[model samples]
Target: MPTPDLLTGELTLTGRITTASNATFLGTIGELVVVYKPRAGESPLWDFPSGTLAHREAAAYKVSEVFGWNIVPHTWLRDGPLGEGMVQAWQEEDPSQNPVDLVPAEAVPGSDWKQVLRGQGEDGQMVALVHEDSAALRRMAVFDVVVNNADRKGNHILAMTEGHRHGVDHGLTFHHEHKLRTVLWGWIGDALNADELEGIDRVREGLQGQLGQQLADLLSAEEVEALALRCDRLRSDGQFPAPSGQAPAVPWPLF
Candidate 1:
């Protein structure tokens, strides 16, 4: 989920992110990455697939609960200067190094909540000073596969200095297709770890009980099925199962 800048109370766009799918800006309401929704008079025109976007993002939060991972921040649908938008709690980092900058564990210089772990990324990819030891990064990798995230770019995973790896930009997830793109390629083809397996087990057990009912409110029938399928596969595999999709690999420009 993208957040509104805090400094401005609302995100006021000073510039445009022409290259993005949603209307993006270089402005600051508080933390950076203020995503402005396309207003009625805007160039892109406001025909936002709001229902789908919100559904997916909210579902991310819901399914994350299955693993006991904090996949969601404070997100609410609100109107900003741009129009209807989703306001998210902001994570700290400079977006300038987005897409391919690496935050070595040493780069984080203060007391913070996230930690930077060395993860595999493509060559020439930009890296940022993600807050360093991600508490649930490995868990996040598993989540990405289940959701089939198509935009797991470098910027999406924020590693705070103290080690909480936060996964963001979940708008492109749950397409009912297998298009998993991301910067956490370091774990490609790797098997699930013991803790990760435990998390999956927890989710699997919960799916038939409380978590499934909770997800019913947040996800579509298909989405819920997909979630169940992913969980089932993990339980059966006892490992990070192989990529079962038709694509050669995950897409480019993870963000």
Candidate 2:
């Protein structure tokens, strides 16, 4: 791990993350590979407070740690070449494993896969958007719900060689509203397993103590209350929630 001063050292941009809504860069601090998203480069959004996306990214990492599920990679906030931004460890996804795939509609049947939705592919063939029903992916879905993640695009999931799945690009989170939008809704309406419910319980307990205090440093008071409320709702409901029916359930350009 790079120390704060080392991470704040000169950032040499290796490449730009063009698909991001805001300006993002792939850079390195000495031998460590990192992704940097400067606050100055953030495009303002009407719903979220201005210029705090980088902070939210770091907060999401904290929440991931709270759950003891390594769904999110190590992240921090520091000054970079552009401005203050979120810096995260770079994950090299397995070249052979695709996290999300468009398989033929008729070709999907295995219990190991969860079909998220069906649509027509560019080739005019009926296809199903599917992801592996692995424990890592399931943990990520739970993390999304806890944070009220507004955008969980398919490509945000990284598949590592040993089958570990890491979620990235969590800037659109911690909203005080029901802004849960994502492609990982395969477990909709499913009952929460005992372990999953226990995780939620731990989060609820943390909100009244250390986790809540840490979140206060990165999020607004209202957002912190909303976070606690989400834990309450999930605990009471005891299931993965379905779409609220008030907003789009999934993000556009799913990939």
Candidate 3:
């Protein structure tokens, strides 16, 4: 839960999120900025699914700790213009980073295509995709795959000038299926390195313990099974497993 002071809405009204959702860019509350995602009225693909948006955000934040990426922000349970919502940390936007635009691995110097792909602007213009460190980014991507991140678009990655790429918008994560899709596809078939394998081991160990207990609150039984399947594949193959069945790679537009 977020502290009362962080939950207060005032100066933030001056700003808003450019995304399609009913999101508002709440002013920075500490090291993090807050965003409000109100429930959608009536969408075609999905209809708020009844009552799980905030909880979905909560579960993703918790699962993020296990993955080692800081995508989920500290959410304060509060009422929003739409209804109850989560107040998330604001990620500082930097122009140096490319927005989900695919960059060729060869064009970027010193970047190993096998390990990870560094993002560059479409016209061969140089832009920071995920810092110079491809190793760290690959690990996070693997974690995302393990969680079955339904969305991992390139724009979701916010590259800071100081050499860190932060991910945002995780309200639709942790579902129990092969619903993985996103722009971070640099490591589609590359095998997981040692440290990467070790991290999966940690998550597997945690799943049956306190983590599983916690996931229970946010995931359904089928979803939990999906998570298990992903981990099992990673552990067995040491590489990203192929898609099991034919599933739409992307979500509906309104979502």
TM-score of each: 0.65, 0.95, 0.74
Per-residue alpha-carbon lDDT of candidate 3 for residues 79-111, written as tens digits (9 for 90 to 100): 655566666776677887553443455444344
Tens-digit lDDT string for candidate 1 (1-255): 333334226566667657756655444565455444433322332322344565466567666766777755544445667565544556675444332345544454444323323444566443343422233666777888777676776667765555556777676677654566655544445567777888788877787888778767756777678777877876677665444566644345434
Strongest candidate by lDDT: 2
Under the 3 Å rule for N, CA and C atoms, how many clashes does model 1 have? Answer: 34
lDDT of model number 2:
0.89
Every candidate's lDDT:
0.59, 0.89, 0.61
Candidate 1 structure, TM-score to reference: 0.65
Candidate 1 segments whose C-alpha is farther than 4 A from its true place: 1-19, 24-51, 78-84, 94-135
Residue 10 lDDT in candidate 2: 74
> Candidate 3 at residue 212, lDDT?
85
Q: What's model 1's lDDT at 206? A: 80
lDDT of 1 at 11: 64
For model 2, state the Cα shift of residue 6 in Å.
Answer: 4.3
Name the candidate, 1 or 2, with the larger lDDT value. 2
Better of 2 and 3 by lDDT: 2
Using TM-score as the measure, the top candidate is 2
Q: lDDT per residue, candidate 2, 140-191, as tens digits?
A: 8888999999999888999999989999999999999999988898898988
